[model samples]
Target: MSVLVRRAALTVVAVAATVLVAITPAQAEPEGGTKPLRDALRAASQGYQDARTAIANAKKREGELSEEILASQARVADLSAAVGRLAAAQYRGGSSAQLQALLSSGSPESFLDTAATVRYLSERDGAQVTALKAAQATLARQRKDLDAAILEQENQLKELRKRQDEALKALRSAGGGDPTLGFGDLPANATPAPRNPDGSFPSEGCSVKDPTTSGCLSPRTLHAYNETKKANFDHYVSCYRSAEDGGEHPRGKACDWSSAAKGFGGMAVGAEKDYGNKLAAWYIANADRLGVLYVIWFRQIWMPGTGWRSYFGSGDPSSEHTNHVHLSMR
Candidate 1:
């Protein structure tokens, strides 16, 4: 090969080696083949939220500083007006004003008091004006600092969003935009999850008449939900949670049947584990017909073609699905 071509090939090899070194085995293969990418996306999302909060706080502080600056300016103005009037009167009448008061005094003590009052008033006004001036300067500096902080926060948010988008792209590549990735080869008849009559899952099901979310659910999700209710399972089966603001839950396409009554935690090793497993298996078995996208239970995740894989959530049973059977649809 020519010298130029050899150099070009060497550069490419160097870049490839750098990438291989930077990406760990877990990242290359990913935990459960996709968890690493999902983890990256989650970190990025949290960073975005943090950056937004910082920006909001900075703005609030900036507003407070502005108010302080305004109040200080008013103080300085009032001080100036009072001092200015006193100065003008002194300049107009000069020492004669004090002499006139001194002559009107009926006694030596009264005359001395008139002269002392002039000196005391002038000194007090001067000291107050000086302090107000310093305070105004301090307020201005504080406002400037807040402005810089707000700008910095804005820049950080922009950068975080860029990273968030990159993480999402990597996650999409790892999961192929499909929640059902692990249960093995797709059936020739496999199809997308069922959508609502209006296309996206929404509030309406069983009787849409119930006010609390416990009554609302997507029609297809409700089918599985109603079935679980009858399974006489050891755990409570719940659907249509109203607390969540986003994702499949609020949309009525997800449900959580948890054994933990108060909080999410590991289930007792015997029947609870068995119940969770059965619930998971049932969903996987009926996935095709029921439009199931994925099932999470017993600290594992199952998706079409991907089979069962150990789940690594944020060290929480709720997140790991260890104490609950979390089901989601298309």
Candidate 2:
């Protein structure tokens, strides 16, 4: 072969090799798979840590609340004692010979003294009763609010524990497995059979589709996802739908659910570069049973890559979503 032709052929072959290496699916448990799993594990671990912290905080609050209740009880007791003293004084004054003598003296100064003394005793009794009742009412409200807060904290801890268990299970299952495998060792060239874009599942149900409408998922599918993950599927769907439909997401844009399982768009990175860590966490916990893997927000507007890291805040640039959750499967 001519030198020029040979060089051109070599260059083409090198380029092709690079592309194949880049696009070829990695082995089971490839770094790609492991990365997302690790990220999810980290997030779950963090959640566990947070739950522990919250429990501690709740305990502290309970202690403080108990003290408050005790203090309120003490105040009530004090007020009751004051009322008793006032009652005794009033009773004595009303019947005492000294009071009677003052009233009968007929001197203007003596009569004035008796009237003042009676008024003072009556006012003091009324004031003590009012103060006691007010303290008791205040304590009741504080106790109720504190009790509710404690319940909420307990629920949060329960959810955290559930997620932790799932993460641990995944880690165990994936042990010594290649992290780069897509869809549990499925071939990378295996394109999923096309389905109706309207978001319906196939009869055999190897893959599931999400509705084009914001936040639409079949009740069965939602139940399956929630049951598998032991997480709040409804809340997730609600949040996604709200974000997609609230006028910010352009019409006709739908979230990509399958990408989540396939590790699309460098999704494996958990530390900071991973844009969809929370979404991935949900997917990892639910994907096995749901046949769903990823979710994407479909929109026409361009979102700056700068803000992808904030999972809970206002998405990219728009705030139009007000309802619904997106789902995907592979």
Candidate 3:
């Protein structure tokens, strides 16, 4: 009887195992019975990777273009200096005494030679001035083109980030456990505010000096910068207003701050000082609350250190801010 019971128990265990194997749960399928979303997300990731490559290429191109622009500018400056010297010489020759010295030669051939030399110098001076002007114009156009390209690449990067964020969100939503998974844990109500009438923000009041106009600022860009500043400030205030809240604060401008530097009028020392100080003060005021370990802004391109520190009478502090949180609004 004991042997019979042992065999019966083994048979029952095998039958249960077979039933469990035969009735396995179905694998989960994503929504809509289509795999297009997953495919799209993969494509978007690839596109983001491509965008990073494009950004690197754009930066290299910008550097090359900037070097060319500088070299061209230096050539123009040299030509300008040469022209100035020649003009001074011509002016000195205009005096009656100098003219007499040139003309009152021992022989006609000597006088002709002196006259020919003066004429040659004048002709060369004129040619140099013309060449300098042409070079300046060409380099100015090239710089403008490079600036536009940099802006374009930056915008493309922003778009890529947006798409990547969306892709991540879609993947998380499809994966199903937490709705917020893969969607960066943003505040529940983190929607950006609409632009006010006149396309300005109430919190922003700074004006961007105009490069084109003599003393006036660019109203349009000034307004835009102010709005961006306000928006960034608002984001920061919203995120880190309290220690209990675990949100990220704004660390940089929404768009490229370097672009606004162009509208800072001429290369006046005081204007740069004032703008730099204001930015620094703003950072300092919210530094602790915002958890901003470091903030860097490269006027020309992205670099290792705090561009602000260099501006603030400090040695290069680029490497020091590496451990701090990195936030790039642009």
Highest lDDT against the true fold, candidate: 1
Model 3 spans with C-alpha error above 4 angstroms: 1-33, 93-102, 176-330
Cα error of candidate 1 at position 32, Å: 4.9
Q: What is the lDDT of candidate 3?
A: 0.41
Q: What is the lDDT of residue 92 in candidate 3?
A: 79
Evaluate all candidate structures by whole-model CA lDDT and list the values in order.
Answer: 0.58, 0.43, 0.41
lDDT for 54 (candidate 3): 62
Error of 3 at 65 (Å): 2.1
TM-score against native, each model: 0.43, 0.40, 0.41
Per-model RMSD to reference: 22.3, 16.8, 24.0
Highest TM-score against the true fold, candidate = 1
Q: Which of candidates 1 and 3 is the stronger one according to TM-score?
A: 1
Q: lDDT (0-100) at residue 92 of candidate 1?
A: 99
| lDDT string, candidate 1, 58-90, tens digits | 667778777877887787787778768767877
What's the lDDT for residue 295 in model 2?
28
Worst 10 residues of 1 by lDDT: 24-33
lDDT of 3 by residue, 1-330 (tens): 699999999999999876554222110001111245434443554455446556666787788889888898888888878878867876776546556868688888998887887677657767888998898898889889799869978887796777556555544454421221110122222223343443222332113442322222223333333443653532111111111112111111212122123221112235443443334344433332332222332211111111122211012212111111122221
Q: Which parts of model 2 are misplaced by more than 4 Å?
A: 1-9, 12-60, 87-102, 144-146, 170-330
In the predicted model 3, the residue pairs found to clash are 210-217, 305-318
